[model samples]
Target: MLAPVTDHPDTAPLVDAVRQLRGAVAASSLPLPVEQVSAERTNRVELLNQLDDYVLPRLTSIDAPLLCVVGGSTGAGKSTLVNSLVGDVVSRSGVLRPTTRASVLIHNPDDTRWFADQRVLPGLARLTGAPTQQDDPGQLRLVASRNIPPGLALLDAPDIDSVVEANRDLARQLLAAADLWLFVTTATRYADAVPWGLLQQATERGTSVAVVLNRVPVDAMEEVRADLAGMLMQQGLGQSPVFAVLESRLSEQGLLPAAEVERMRSWLSSLAADSRARSIVIRRTLDGALDSLTGRASALAGAVTAQEMAAQALAQAAHEPYVRARGEIEEGISDGSLLRGEVLARWQEFVGTGEWFRQLDEGVSRVRDKIASVLRGRGRAAPVEDLGEALHTGVAALIASHGESAAMGAARNWRSLPGGSELLADDRSLAQVSPQFDERVQRLVREWQGDVLEMVRSEAGGRRTTARLLAFGINGIGVMLMLVVFSATGGMLAGAEIGVAGGSAIVAQRVLEAVFGDQAVRSLAAKARELLLRRVDEVLADERARYDQALGRVELDPGAAEQLDRAISQLKAVR
Candidate 1:
C-alpha cells in the first residue's frame, strides 16, 4: 500500500511544484483564431479546475475526510440517496428536474472543521446551513450532521444532464474534485449516454467509484443487476461495487427504506473508519491526477506553439509586401522614369529649348555667353519654380502609388490566412493605407526639394560669382540638379523617351559642371539621391506600422509554451 501523503518525504516540494505548474498552465492563452482553438481552451479550463479543486488541496491535506461526490443524470435520485446514506433529511430531495441547484456537503458534526473552511473546492463560497431562497448555485452549502461517520463527507452535486448548462458544468467540476464517486442512476437511466460518459472518465482517472441502481422494480431486480454488472465489467469498472435498491415507497420524511440503503451505507462507513483504506483511495486518485498532468500539459504546449506559428505567418505576410514596395520605389527613382510628362516639359522651358539645345555642343565659355545673351534678349524669367512643382508632383505620385499597392497586397494575402479575416474585420483600416499617407507623402516631397536647393547653394559656395552660375541663377541650377538625379542611371532607360530624357540629363550635367566642376556635380547628385531615398524609407515604415498595430492586439506570448513545458518537467521530477 502507498504511504500516507502527509508522511511522505517529498510532499511539500511536490505541492510547491504543482502550484507552480498550475500558474504556468493558467498563463497559457490561445488568443489566435486557429483550428480547434475552442476545444483546447475548454481543455485548459478543465485542467486548471482539476488542479485547484482537487490535486493541490488533496496533496496538502492528505489526511482530510474522504470526499465522495454523488453524481448522475437528471432525476437520478442523487439527493434522496445522500439523505438515506446519512439517515437524515440534510439534503433536499424533490420531483423537480434539478432538485440540487447548489451543491450540499454533509459531514459528521465532529469533522466540521474540515468542510467549513476553504481547504478544498476553494472556487466555491461556503454556506453554513441548508440552501435558502437567497442562495446562488455557485455556493457550497455545508450541513454538519451527527448521523454521518467521522472521516467521510458526502457532496450532492447537480445533475450531469441538467437542462441548465451551468448546472451540468458544475456537476462535472464537482465530480473532477471527488476522491470517490457514488454515481446514482435508476434502472431507466442506467444505460444513459451521459452518466456512462462520466463513468468512463472516472475509470480513466482511476477514481474510486460505486454504482447504486436506484428504484429497481422488485421483479426485474436480478436481471437488471446482472446486466449492469456486465456493463461495468466491460467498461473496466468491474472492481467498483454495484448495489441494487428495490423499488420502494418513501417514508414520511421522504427517505429511502432503511433496509434498502444499509449495505451501501455500511460500505461507506467502513471505508471512512479505516485510515489505511482511506489513504489507498486518496493515493489512487491523487497519483492518477498527477500522472494525467503530463499529457494535458503537453497538449496545451502544442496549442501554444500553434498560436505562435500562426502569429508569425500573419506577420510575415504583412511584411513581404512592404519590402517589395520599398524596392520598387528605389528602382523608380534611378531609372529616369520620373523625368517624363510635366517634369520633362518644365525642364525644356527652363533651358530655352530648340535652338538653345543645338548650341550646347559649343565650348563651355561660348555656350555660357550665348545662354546669357539669349535669356537677357528674351526678357522672360526662367521657369525654375514651375520645374520644382513638377518634380514634386512626379515623386509624390511614385511613392503614393507603391504605398497603396503594398497595402492592397498585404490585405489580399491576409484574407487567405487562418483567422486573418476576423482581424481585418476588427480593423478595416488595415485594408487601405493610412488616411494621412497622402499628406505625409506631399510633405516628404516638399522637404526633399528644399534639401536639394540647399545642397546646390552649399556646393556653389565660392563659385556663385562665376558667369555660368549668374546666367542660370541659383533656382535654375537647383532644378537642373534635380533633373540630373532622376536620370543618373539613364543607361537603364529604353525607347524614344530615353533619348529625350538622356539628352535632357546631359544638358543639365554640362551646365552644373560649368559652375561646380565635374567632381563636385557628381558628389552633389549622390548626396541628394541618398537623402531622398532615406526619407522615402521612413514614410513607408509608418504606413506598415498600421498593420503591425493590428497584429499586436492578438499576438500570443512567445515564451508561454516553453514556460509550460518547464513547469511540467519540474512537477514530474518531484513526483
Candidate 2:
C-alpha cells in the first residue's frame, strides 16, 4: 500500500476495501435467474484473482520486482522464446502440442525472496528448480537464473488456446496476475479469434502489453507486420510496440538464432533497468483493476439480491395457503357447521328437544331446578358422554380435512416456484398431511372438552350453585358450552334447517342463564368461544410448521448486499 507520504493519498485503506468487497462476493451464492452463469462465474474468478494475485501483493511492496507473463496460442513457441530471452534451458521446450503443463517463473537470484513467498500470485505454490513433485497446475516452478536481470521475472504460462479447458483457464488467470503480458503469436495464428479476444480484454483492462510475431518469413515480413500493426490499431492497441522474430535455422539447443530475438530481449532489459518504467506498468494495471471492481461488485450484489428475493417468494408461497386454511377452519366453527349431524341428534335426544323452549319460559329459577332434578338421574351420564364423543369426532374430522387441504394447497403453490419444484419432486410426501394428523386432532378435541368442563366449574358461584352443578354434573354444562361455541353465528332459533341442534344451544343458554345470571351467560359464551378458537389455532400452527421447515432449508445469504454496498462505498471514497 501507499506509505503515508507527505501529500499523496494512502492506498492501504483502498486495498483493504477492495479485499472486503472480494470476500463478500466470494461467499455469495449465484442461484437461478442470474443473467448468465458462465459470465458471472468468470467475473467472480477474475475479481478474486486480481485481489489475491496483483493488487494486494503489488500494493504491499510498490518497489517489488516486475513479472512479465509470456502467453500465446497453442504451438506458438512461447517456451522456446522464454528460454531464448533468458539465454538458458531453465524452461523445458518440446515438440508436444500444448507443451506447457505447469508454469515456470525465472528470476534473478538477487530478487528470489520477492517471488519466493505468496505475496504476489498467492494462489500459486512456489517451487525451486525442475519440478520433483506431482505436476500440480496450481504451482509455479521458480528457477533462480543469473542470466536474467535483477529487477525482472519471466513466467512461461500454458497455451491460451489449449485443447484442455484447465490449461486455457490457467493461462487466463496467469495473464491477469501479470504486470505485463508479453504476447507471442505465430505469423499464421496472429488473426485467430481466441488470442484477439484476450488482447481486447488487455486493452479494456489498460494493462501494459506487447506482441511478438514469431516465425515470419523474410519475404512477407513487411506485409504481415503491416497487417498485424493495422489490426492492433483497429483494436485500440496501436500504442503497444510489436517485434518480429524471423524464421531462421535453429542452434544446437533447438532455439532461434541469437540475432532473431535480440530486439525483444534488449527491450525487456531496458524495461527491467528502468525503475520508472516498471513502476508505470505496475500502476497502470493496478489502477485498471481497482477501477473495474465497482461495476463487478455491484453486479454480484444484484445476483445476491435476486437469490434473496426468490427465496422469500418461495417461502411466502408455502405459507399463504395454510393461513387461508386456518381462517376457513375458524369460519366453519363460527358458522354452526360442525354441530349439524351426530352432535345435534344426540343433544336433542338428551334434552327432549321440541318442548325445550316451552320449558325455558317457565321462570329462570324454576327452570334451573327442574333441569337439575332431571339431569341427576343415574342414567344421564351415558347420553352426555355419547354427545361429547360425537362433538369430539366431528371437530377432529373438521380439523383433519382442513389440514389436508392446506397441505395440498401449499404443495400446489410451491410447485410453481423456481427451486420449490425441485424440492417437491424429490420429496412428494409434502403434498399430503402426516398420517398422525388425525390422531393429534382427536387429542386436541379431548383436551378442549376438558377445558370447557373446568370453565363450567369455575363459573358456578355459591352453595346453591354448587349443588345445582353437582346435580346437573359438569358433563352436562360442559357440553352446553361446546354447543354454544358451535352456534356463534346464531342458534337454530334464527330460522335455520338445523333448528333441532339450535334448540339444544338455546336450552343450554337458558339453563346457564338460570344458573349464572344473564351477564354471566354471555360472559361464559364469550370465554368458551375464545378457548375453542385458541385450541384450533394451536392445531393449525402445528400443521403449518411442516411447510415452515421446508422453507427454512433454502438458506438465503443474509446481509450480503449490505456488505457489498459498504465495501463499494469505501472504495469510492478512496477513489
TM-score per model over all chains: 0.91, 0.84
Cα lDDT tens digits, model 1, 483-516, are 8888856656678667778778888888788788
> Per model, how many backbone clashes are there?
0, 2
lDDT of 2 at 316: 84
Model 2: runs farther than 4 Å from truth?
1-9, 19-38, 91-99, 159-168, 186-196, 213-231, 244-257, 352-378, 422-439, 461-468, 490-498, 535-557
The 0-to-1 C-alpha lDDT of every candidate, in the order given, reads 0.86, 0.79
